[model samples]
Target: MLTLLAQTGSAGADSQSLAFFNFITTHWQFCLLHFLEFAIWGAWIVVLGNLLNARGFTRKEIGSIYACMPIGTMISILILGPLADKYFSTQVMIGVLHLVGAVLLILMARTDNARRFYWLTLLYALAFSPTLGLVNAIVFKHDADIFGGLANQGFPWIRVFGTIGWIAAGLSHTLILKKGQPVNANPLLLAAGLSLVLGLYAFTLPADPSKVALAAADAVAGEPAVAAVADVGILQGSIEMLSRHPIFFLVTFVGAMAMGLYFAFGALFLEKTGVPPRTVGPVMTIGQWIEIFFMLALPWFLGKDNVNMNWVLLVGICAWAVRFGVFAIGKPLPMVLFGVAIHGICFDFFFAAGMVNANLIAPESLTATAQSVYGFLVYGLGMYLGSELSGWLNQYFTKPTTAADGTPDTVTNWRAFWAIPGVCVAICAGLFFMSTLGRPPAGDGSNAPAEIPAQASEVGE
Candidate 1:
């Protein structure tokens, strides 16, 4: 009997291992979905400003261009988020939008005139913004297929590939392009081509069927502007989810703030530390590449079945504070790389982990909106406010200096500027732990673990 049982157990283990391999293999489309989706952003995001500078655009004009996407996101989510969740298949919308965006991006590369470029970008943003939420919704919807009852584990594993795509795009900028010249229309051309490929590729991925039960957002998809606000409350489930776990909303806001600060000033700070401009994209991407390590381990850290979401978020906040401190020190190369690398901890814990938590408790009917709410808080509002604030701070802390040709150059007070955000985030991290915040309980409800005492009363509401 013992010999027979041992044989059965060994066969079972082998069978399970084979099944896991099959799952990963079959999910290549999802991985490509994430990879190409991010590659589109990566190709142009870091290089666009540099390219515009090369084109002789003013700072204000460039700032307006930067502002367009957030504005587009805020607007696009209203229509697309609801449409995907309630009325249309998510993957189909993703494909269609990318197709539209591809044309706009190509037009952007071909046009040098400011007004035409601005409008093309704005239109592209409208087409592109919803894809961020749509992709997350699609991934979350299919997570169960990857890990059966343990869906959250699959998210980080799958998401790590998106970081890879971003890294690949950065490398293309650094290695394939000539050294020391600002990334020109070529980056957008690359993005446009990728967008077109992804547009076609999206349709080949797994389907995310629209919810049969319609929500208020769907009823008003074509309605007038004011009607949307009055009617938008129809997203009662998503709204309730936020209200129930106020802490999630708070943490999301703070996470946005921290990331906003980093986005606004991180590159400039590194340049001040003497890193060359051409290398900036690769150096910055070091964070995303390293993020894969933490992302790989996240499932283990959060436990196989049940975990506390707040703990992960809190640690991420702490990592941000520490990372900011590292940046503040204004250290040299290898050491500075350590600071950049901390992004693995910072992003995986806060943003990526937060997504897991958001999906965990959200009603099936409202998953897209839930993710949209998070995106609007972080990428939309947070980034916009951060960019504006960073502009003011940049001017405030700058000292005018003369270059070798007697022309004026702006010397930023890097140490002081970096210290301000560092101190602020450290304080925020401390305050985050001390606050009475409720996190969405981790795990699918079938095997839910208890939450921390601070949020115990509000755990399931």
Candidate 2:
């Protein structure tokens, strides 16, 4: 009997191991999707301004081009969010959108006409922004119930690989691709290819649309006499639940504001620093590597016993301050590179942590809407404000000098340009510190009332 029991136990362990292996194998496609999605952006986003400049576009034009992303994201939140919830499978929508983006990317590669480039890029941005949220929805739909909470945990790990893909694309542009040119088509083509691959791969993800149908069916069965009433109740309940959480709304606003400044200033700072266009890829790679390491350790650092969300956010704010401070000081390339490394803390803590906090505060019925709202704020309105402001600032602080051939050369007052972001980070830090102090919520994962009120909450709290 003892021998039989031992044999049974061994078999059970083998079954458990196989189940875990199968889980990862089945879901591996989602990781690949994320990798390629980010790889597309990584190839061009950090260096697109330089490309435009090389092609005779002005600094203001480049800022306007970059600002398209946020604008597209904002527009999609109103249109795409409801459509994804009602009509299409999230994966199908993502696949279609990315495939369209791929074609637009190819079009971008073929164009030197600035006006054509601007419109095409706007199309690409609109298609791409919705996919970020859709991909997450698809991933969460497949995660096991026992491991549902692990969605945020494991998702970041997979997403970090996307950054790795980004770094690889960046390095490739610097080394094998650009051939030392200020602007090259290779990176854009590479991004296009990866996007196509992701579009094709997205079709293979585990089915998610069925759940929406199943919920509708269940609702019909439960209230056949009043099906319309039941539908209204679900919608009303979701809105009411979201409305009750003021902190969630406030944090979303803060997230938008911080991200706006970060994205806008990040591109402008690199351009002002006189970093050669080809070299910016590797410099960005250094920052991405730091981001990867920080993300890998985040679960441990922010887990139950370690740092609370407030402390993590505070450190992130400080890191942003330090990063821009280094830039403001007019440091050498190496020091500037080191400061860029703080991207790990700045992004992972502020943005990624904000996602986690959103997850914590959102009720199950409103989960998708809540997360989508956060994206809308950060990528849409926040980015819009950041890009416009940064452009104005760049125009104000940098004087135009004439090149030897009579073309204009833009010379930035690096100290003043960099100091602006440093001050922004300082203000973010102050707001966060005060919010944390006012309402000290139980930091131990209990769903106690959040310590901070919504209107005053910092970006990720």
Candidate 3:
């Protein structure tokens, strides 16, 4: 279906048909690039906690390991985004990042020490963080229209293959990699191998460098306009833009708080509710699959004439609250599994919708920075705080009720731990409702009455 979509165009549209064919033929390498890129992360990420526990790593350290993701994301926002935009091709940068991450994974495989593991993982995360944005930039540059439906269609199709790669990795671990119990090495090896493949393949993709327009502007001026512009302190300009919109900051804070709470206990909730370790991977994968579906449908849904962004976001928050509530109540496994599907609306509506909202409000030149800011809030500040809180809560709520050997006398007080996030969600939802008392701006690409700059335009060429 994707191949057909990539090859065909409207009737009598010979030029567009040829362009579509050329796009597919030329960029076919991206399919493999993305496949391996995500395969590496997926191989172990969902199961890392189990692996750490098996190794007898402290629960606190395990939580800290999860914190690596957001911490890396935060660092990338501050340093990598600007550097990539200024100095490197997005494809090459991503390739290098993955290669470095692969090395770290290999090193992690060789280590039995927990501290060494944590330090190496953090390094790997730092190298890996910037690539997320770089890859998206590369894809969007090829198909510039943010609102163009075809661009949305192509990327998700490529990404879905990544999920397939993840499922393959999961099954490999379950069947071949581990004799019986879940082990760390299998997923790490799978991730490392795929990372190397992605790194090598990336060099072959179309070279997409930073500052195309600025470079063009420089060439016309014949005196390095980019250098002069950089010298004038662009950081200050971006910072000023952010300061003018206090509401964006508040939104970011709220998002971070909610996300932190979610990540801290989300998986633990399931584990306590009687879901087995083997089933966790499949259940989480179901959520990713659902998210891909929502991403495919998002442009259509948001583009509808009377769609309210706040309402969409509210629905997502409600889904999130219900998802946790279901887990808290310890429903049957199938019902709990069905609730995982809410991830599509919960994640997409919050993150993707927030990204689009930011795009609608930021200055054209600051689009990358604005996106980076959002990433910083969600992954960096939000997840870091959340992870720590989760670790503490996990220890606090889950008492050691049995000896090392299996025993029937064990008991767990799960309700209080689960309810903390529930209350947080309800409060955040209420705050959001109050903040957007008036309906969200229609999907006409108009900014709300908020003090957004006039220079920001939709990059959907």
Clashes of each: 0, 1, 1
What does candidate 1's lDDT look like per residue over 1-461, in tens digits? 99999999999999977866676687777778878888888888766665765675544455567667777767765665655565677788899999999999989998889878888888898898778656655665654454553544444445556777888887787664567655568789889899999999888877753353123323222111212333555467557767876666766776666665566457656655776656766788888777767766665666644465667778887887778777767776777788888888888777767766665666765555565566667667766665555556656776768989998665767777667767766776777677635644456655533211110100000
Lowest-sum lDDT 10-residue window in model 1: 452-461
Residue 309 in candidate 2, Cα distance off native in Å: 2.1
Residue pairs with clashing backbones, model 2: 439-451
Error of 3 at 80 (Å): 2.3
The candidate scoring highest on TM-score is 3
TM-score of 1: 0.76
Task: Report the number of backbone clashes for model 2.
Answer: 1
Model 2: runs farther than 4 Å from truth? 1-26, 144-153, 176-179, 204-209, 213-258, 261-268, 271-274, 303-307, 359-373, 404-407, 442-461
Q: Give the per-residue lDDT digits (tens) of candidate 2, residues 1-461.
A: 99999999999999977975675575667667667767777888777766776787665667777788888777666666456646777778877888898899999989998888989989998898777556555655555542454453445444555676677778776664454456577677888888888888888776663765534432322111122222445456446645765544554455455455555456446645667666776677777787777766665666663337767767876787787788888668778877877788877776666655655556655544555555556667777776766667666776879989998687778688768767866776777677678654324355432221111111211
lDDT (10s digit) by residue, model 3, range 1-461: 87676667444488756865665565666556556666677777776766676676655777787788778877776676557767877777887888888888899887879899989888988988677555555655555432143454455544555656665665555553444454556677777888888888788887763466535422222121123234455467458557855555565556566566555445545555666656555556777777767755665666554255567667767666777677676678777777666777777766666666665566766654555455556667777877767666656665656656775333446667656776777677777778777746434444322211111111000
Candidate 1 residue-wise lDDT at 204 = 85
lDDT of each: 0.66, 0.64, 0.62
Task: Give per-residue lDDT, candidate 3, residue 123.
Answer: 93
